[model samples]
Target: MQTEHSFTLVVAYVDDLLVTSSDSTVITILKTALNSAFTITDLGALKYFLGIEVSRSDFVQQLSQFLSEPRAPHWSAAVHVLRYLKGTINFGLFYPANSGLSLEAFSDADWGTCIDSTRSLTGYCVFMGNSLISWKTQK
Candidate 1:
């Protein structure tokens, strides 16, 4: 079932429901209504969902991949990511309350970056206000 309130929007998939809102009261009310209709357990704040780790602050939200298994180069890459996170534990995207809502993106490609396949390396990041909401790198 799908439900939308003035402050909250809920989308359900099978037994999973994703609720989003700017106000916690709206979310609580929705969850209560849903509980009355069906048996549900509130997981509280979202920390880990699927294979992604989510962290949030007053100004920004951050997401990172949670590795379950890694071998060779993948292990090394995962270690590097962990090191970066450790070093930047206190760092977060800066988005002031007065920041604009404009979205901006920057992308670039390095031709023939892959020595074996001659594939180009492409990377991009999208920012809403001063917070990076999306980023990707591919070859």
Candidate 2:
């Protein structure tokens, strides 16, 4: 359905329906129309859907999380990650409006650094126009 500010699209699969729109008003209208024809319940704003947590703010839309059962080591690792995130809560990548569209990357590896596995640890970051778009580290 079309609205002045946005267009709404509904994708139906089995008994589930995902309604999407850029404008909240359009979404509201679509929900009302659907309710009139079918017994559908609004689940409110999207948060944790399936296995992912959806978070949005004025400058960012973040999808986070994976399904995992924590073991003892995993629990301690999770706490460490939480502490790191808390310490860098305000840190983020920023791109200026006039930034050039350029791609850059940096990577490094320490051969045989992991004593237990005798495997190297490697990490890298990819940037697009001065904005870091992807990063990863692993053994």
Per-residue lDDT of candidate 2, residues 1-139 (tens digit): 7757677788676777778886777788778998999999888876754323566664112112222454666566667778888999999768798876787889999899798999999999987777777789999
User: Where is the poorest 10-residue window by lDDT in model 1?
Assistant: 58-67
Per-model C-alpha RMSD = 12.9, 12.9
The residue-by-residue lDDT of candidate 1 on 5-43, one tens digit each, is 346667566777778786677888889998999899998
- Superposed Cα RMSD, model 1: 12.9
Q: Residue 59's C-alpha lDDT in candidate 2?
A: 19
Clashing pairs in 1: none
TM-score of candidate 2 against the unseen true structure: 0.37
Distance from true location, Cα of 17 in model 1, Å: 1.2
Q: Which sections of candidate 1 miss by over 4 Å?
A: 1-6, 60-139
